[model samples]
Target: MSSFDNTHITALTDLINKAVQDIIAEYASAGRAVPSLDTLESGLFQVPEETPARLTKAIQIVEAACAQLSCTVAPPGSVMINKSLEHEEPACLLVVTEARIADLLLDKPEGLPASELASRSGLDTRKLTRILRLLATKHCFKEVKPGVFANNRLSMKLLSSDTVSSIVCLLTDESLRASAYLNETLTDPSERDGGIPFIRATGYPFFDYHKTRQGLKKGERFPRAMVGWGDVTGKGLLAKVYPWTSQPANTTICDVGGGNGHVTMNLMKAHPHIKVVVQDQPQVIEMAQKFWAKEYPGAMEKERVQFIPFDFFKDAAVQGCDFYYIRSILRDWPDTESELILKNVRQAMKQGSRVIIHDTVLRDAVRTPESSSNASVHHDVAPEPLLPNYGVARVRTYELDMTMMNLLNSQMRTLPEFIELGKRCGLRFEKLYEVGETDLVEFSPI
Candidate 1:
């Protein structure tokens, strides 16, 4: 009946306390206090420099150790049940987002009664109270009083206005539905003809499904969701992490399969000297045109941006650009199709041309000789008593890996996988850039 012995518990306790001290010190050094979870604004992590190496490591250790410690002490059945029901919290979140509860409570810092909130959102009062209470217990929204609900720092992110909400809805609705069919898709032998779980759930592959009349109505939210995808995955820091300023003036940076051209827009805004070519399907190109026009009219006026409708699977990317950037594109396809896409970009490369792929580069839970060899980018592993991949701290990337598989029968590649994929396309691994949430793998002609 006893859990991890004294030594194990002590190790975890020490790790947590050490991490907490490190975090507190970092805040003190910055002349700032550790942010309150209730405050409705950006926290320390918003400022990249504020979350430097020491602070980041500490935060990871704290997250992993605390969760591990809890699991170590908790009943096995209790933990298993909690993990099994994880989907329910997000389902509640979907309800809150769909009802615009966050937006309604935006002005009500003190909070709103559950009955009033339910009436405004057109939901049953008792049901709404239960949902809000569940979310509150999860630290999303807060139950300020006996039956009153309010927006907290976390709930503010669910505000209908934020781009994060788009991705949230997509994941909770379409992706969630697709995920439900994962077991069926994996088991059914007849499902092998490019019929991913998403297709099984909707009777069409992701793109084709989105093109249908019903899909079209829902797909309108998708472009913005793609934009929100960038925001959620730390694409805003892409320009800063990479050496955009080092490139020559007017250097053309081609954004291959760039939906809404969010990455290039960030680059152009940060380093306006660079010219950009945003390439995708004709429909996406059309969307990119409007997006660029509305978001950065001056760039469109000055011809600093170009919209090129090109399918990577069938056509070469814009030739001879200094950098051909592909953000979160390859993860949507299996290795065979991913290679074809890369080969097209490979064909378009000139002597100095480089391909920069921005996606989740997964790390193994334990170190290996192969992982060591492919270590172009240094990923910090957690110390003893924590999962090597930082367990709950880095679970989002692993969850996204599952999401890719469920939706497209694809995966987020490991460094070794990425290196091999590039080599197959006649490209050599150059270097890897680790932005907080994702990794950028750079390649050049073989």
Candidate 2:
């Protein structure tokens, strides 16, 4: 390699080595080994309540540097080809999840023949093998022996019992379907309304489409999908990071546009002293009532939690709650609608009341503190030889931004963009709490 190439590789390798050492030290201190990837009970997937910030930062460095090093050393043509055909992986994953192949293999530790899998899943033997083979290449499943397959740690995540399977299906089904029309929607001059891609593909906007008969069926699966999403996205860690225990007992939290109240349920479960008022659409609140009833019946019976129908765009959230928590809500709409929602929340805020918007804040491949005036919170920027946004380590945020575009023509905002939006709604940015993959941005009434 040339001197320039050597320099880049040295830096990237150094970053990787340091991060690995940090991770090893953490596990060693805890008297635990780093979780294995081969078994379903590895324990890595179950995120602990308190994830050390150092450990999270170390993992981010390892992911960013490794991907950067790969791109730097790999053949340019091969990299381009891999990127071009990347969509095929999700397609294969869809087949595995939809077929309930993981669940079928739950009791079969030894593995099963491709023919047996095909017989059970009702798929052609050869084609089914091809799909499994493709996914196995990605380490999502494993070929324990030639022509025999079994679920690995990754594949086990797709079991029908896992909420993540619902998310996998949602992405591969509706999100992928709408993504096919993204190009056409952008190019078509007559595609005026936002969500044109989803509308063109499904004949209705995201919310409206979900209300139709077909949408209702998909909607039934969506809440479970959100729970799965929260798990994978480290959203459940919000309860741990946000210091809910510091709030006085019985302090009220209004979950604005909180879907099915899964995130709030996590909070309530962790800190039983805090009360919650879960607000969403009528149908969603109805479902949420049933969810709370089954999960924590006393929360409803004692009036510690209330499920109320709310239209944030047209009406304010429950008035004067200690904290207004909105998770994964604003990203589904464009700026105009997002501003309206914030304004309404602002309308109901008391002097000490605060609004917490929990979502991913997008980062660029390169950034500097001086890049934006609204860069009030300091974010960790990757070192040289790695993309500043930590590349694939932070890929989920970018993927979610695209999902929003595919479904609703919305986006994950940058810090500056979020601040601007809040300013428009008479809310000022208070502070930002970095939980893990997502963030909790606090805002107070201006």
lDDT of 1 by residue, 238-264 (tens): 877888788889999999998889778
Q: What lDDT would each prediction earn against the true structure? A: 0.86, 0.85
RMSD of 1: 2.9
Number of the top-ranking candidate, with lDDT as the measure = 1
List the candidate 2 regions with Cα displacement exceeding 4 Å: 1-5, 30-32, 48-51, 192-195, 207-217, 370-378
| Cα distance off (Å), candidate 1, residue 237 | 1.8
- In model 1, the worst 10-residue window by lDDT is 42-51
What does candidate 2's lDDT look like per residue over 1-446, in tens digits?
66555887888899999999998888887887787667678453266345566787788899888888888889999999998898898888888798899998897888899899999999889998999999988998889998799999889889999999999999988898888898998988876655368888988887788899888878888878887887776776877778788899998999999877877887898899999999999998999999899988988889999887989999988898999998888888889899899988999999989999988888777766553344556467677778778899989789878889988788889877998999999989988777677888898888
Q: What lDDT would candidate 1 get against the real structure?
A: 0.86
lDDT: worst 10-residue window of model 2? 42-51
Tell me the lDDT of candidate 2.
0.85
lDDT of 1 at 1: 23
Show model 1 residue runs off by greater than 4 Å: 1-5, 47-53, 192-195, 211-217, 293-304, 369-375
